[model samples]
Target: MIKTSIQSSASEIKSAREDFFYEQPGSLPGTLSIEEDAPPPVIVLIDYNETHATRKQVSTPEECIPYLDSKSVSWVDVQGLGNEDILQRLGNVFKLHPLLLEDVVNVPQRPKVEDHENQLVIIARMVIPKEHKIGFYSEQVGFVLGKNYLLTVQEEPEHDCFETVRQRIRQNKGTLRKQQADYLLYTLLDSIIDGFFPVLEDYGEVIEDLEEEVVSKPTRKTLEKIYRVRRDLLTLRRAIWPQRDAINSLIRDGSTQISESVRIYLRDCYDHAVQVLDMVETYRELAAGLMDVYLSAVSNRMNEIMKLLTVISSIFIPLTFIAGVYGMNFNTERSPWNMPELNWYWGYPLCLMAMGAIAALLVVFFWRRGWFENYSTIADDTNNKNYGSKINLLWRRSRR
Candidate 1:
């Protein structure tokens, strides 16, 4: 039974290690594919300068053209990529290159940065922890930055991690209004990088809880939780690892679109990415360690069960032998050589008393050998503190 359980756990871990998503093999470059059920695109424009800021929902791609070339910094946010016609029109409005449009449309491209002659393209993944939940919502966010305007594309419009940045911009809480389009880009990227912390905190809390569960009462559910935590951490690592490199490239590579000041801010964002990756790796290692501890705990529990059964069977062996001997019919009336005790009046009671004495002596012998003491403490303080009651119950049963 224990062997079967261990094998099942091993298989589950193996299955959980599979990749989340992958591009179709041999697919052509610059191929645009959209999900059949994807929502239509919605365009929102936020144009701001140092003194004033205005936000409007643009119904058409051409509606954003007047603000795109103005002295004020313009932000064109297009949420959703379901409509190819609208997306192509958007590419025309922003003068986006064909390859860049393809990257923006692809739902799960790897995080990267591409510097064009007049624009900087950034592909980033953003994750937001679900409200009052254990998992996260992940989406791809694309950016196209020109001289005085920034174009942002998102896979979906339902959830985003940019609300705080939006609030800061609306309230004019900081120098966001004073900075250029690059600064706005930095602020959004910083928010996306900061978003990882909350999700990591959630995973950290889960790992701590699983540590206790794995040691004390590791059921199939506990094993599932451990595997899930590891899988989520793996997903996080994939998302953040390339993002760190992208930020590093933004810092090191000379891009005219990103100012020196913005590069300095990008350095800070890079640090946060690195920190998030470190936490992910740490949590993954801890989760793996917990799996090992769980297996060992289960094995120990099985050994204790087998040991108790062995002791019980050993005590019964001599009693069974005595009963068998007494049950054998003896011809005491025909020959004196046969068992004489069978004719004795006290034979039946003596046999019963001897069997009882033998059984008691075996129990005492086992007790003296410290078998009971060892059984009582099979679940140690560090490993199975929550199992004390179970151990006590088993001890009482063995005594009876």
Candidate 2:
């Protein structure tokens, strides 16, 4: 039953691996297509100054225009892009270029940074670790920065890393209230970059567990797990690699939309992105190595099974020969020489004794060669080592 389950899981993994999504060839650029099941857009406005801060939900894009030109900073956060008409009005409200709107609503533009005449557009990918699970949720976040207002768009409202940033603004925490729109952009971007750490930490723990499983008791499920981890890390790498360059471009290009002080902060964000990329690459390599280890462990297990079968066959070979000789029908009534053993009363007992003696001798020979002892000892050692490490981990966690 266990073997059947393992085979079933292996087949599922193979099927999943063969299924991949790709863009249609020769697709038009700046396409603004939306998913049919996408949720309606949710608009939120946060206007703040050094002395006061206010947050409210806006129903229409034009409602945000009154606060956009104020001396204080305005953050217009749009949570969905289900309605094309609303998104178009939002583009007009912010004076955003058509291509910029397309990029924001397109759901998954690669992470990038573009500087327009008076605005800077940033496309970033954000990841949130799933609750009570071993995977992550990923989405694209687009930012459009203007003189006194900053606009941000997210594909969905269910999962976002910007809650803390919102809280800081609401509570007037730290110097966030005093800084300009550029500073708000930095805070949000920093939050997005830092979010990768927790997700990566989850992957790190999973990899450690898989490492132990692959070494001590690898199964088809273990191979599937390794492949899944590698695939996720690849996705994360794809999201972060272009983001790092986008940040570096923001710093190096010297966009007037981003202040010098904010650029310094962006440099720090760049370092965090680099660290994330490093960890992802390391995990990917480790996952690949774990796959090799799993294959080798399975091969060794098969060899051990074959060795035991061969030993059993070797012990039975002489016993089978002895039985064949005694059971031969060579005309015992006509020729005494051919039927001497068949006519003797003690012949049957002697033949049985001979076969038993031969079996015992072979068993003793195999024992002396240490095959059985070696196999048992190796299994015991592996189990003991795995248990010891698990116990140590529990002890450390308890201490913490």
Candidate 3:
């Protein structure tokens, strides 16, 4: 189950590839490249003015036509991109350009802005932190802003960060009810940019926990987490970099669809995007640094192991030499030197005492040199530090 969930999170964080939804080289400019498994479109129409607001789900795109031309600002949110017939009807209902519709239908178009005479097309990428997980889910959101109407098309209906905006509209909070559709666009974009904060915050906490693990007990799993965090941050970087440019274009370009007041709000959104990009870059660098720390920790561990082995070998070398010298046969009857010692009444006892004394002296020498003390110090340090449970908790949280 853990493996499956991890694979799922990886796929979720990896947004649909552009090549999968790209039109053929000579294909028509207006041709759509929808995925085979795209969810059927779900239409939600929200029309409001200063006095009141009304939101309802519409079964057909034609149902939204009546509110588009009304004096009140209308927001038609189309989620999912499966049904070509309904999507085509939605384009016709809003009188969207062929190329505009194609861009909206494409799953992974780069975040950008295109201004038509009557409508402004803004393409954006939205990311939502996965529930109780380490990664995020990303999708494309296209905005078509007109005089008093805004059309938004999303890749899927399951995950979105606009619930707060919807709730604000429902509760009649703030000046949203009185603003035009362009202001609504600004509000939603602000929400999208703000959504990145929670995801980044999660990564920050994960990195902190990882730092502890890397210092105390760096393992292969810790290395894997570092790589994963770096990868996810890169994904976020790719997402926000283009989005910042798109928002800047919205602010700098002279598009009538966006009012000056709304552009001012968009500038704030652009700043938030820039802030998110900075956080992503900072986290990425820290993760890269963690890789180096992990390598050093592993090398230090190996050095400790080798030191222990060297100490044992040093103590045994003299004892092995003494044993080898005694084991040699000099033919005691033929050589007086060997024969006299061999016949001594206490010879075996004296030989044993000499070997024991030699071993004890060697041990004392090593102790005086602080070699033995280091082993005790290392053991004490390892016993005193206790962060294993915390590391496990972090890993469990990330897995979930």
Report the lDDT tens digits of candidate 2 across residue range 57-107. Answer: 999999998898999999999998789899989999899888888878886
Tell me, what's the RMSD of every candidate? 8.4, 5.4, 6.6
Question: Model 1, poorest ten-residue lDDT window?
Answer: 386-395
Deviation from native of the Cα of residue 223 in model 2, angstroms: 2.7
Q: Over the stretch 192-302, how does candidate 3's per-residue lDDT look in tens digits? A: 988887888788878877877887788888977987787788778878898999999988876888888888888878878877887788777877777777777777778
Q: In angstroms, give how far residue 400 of model 2 lies from its true place.
A: 18
* lDDT to native, each model: 0.83, 0.83, 0.82
Native-referenced Cα lDDT, model 2 = 0.83
Candidate 3, run of 10 with poorest lDDT: 375-384
TM-score of each: 0.87, 0.86, 0.85
- Give the poorly placed runs of model 1, Cα more than 4 Å off: 1-28, 374-400
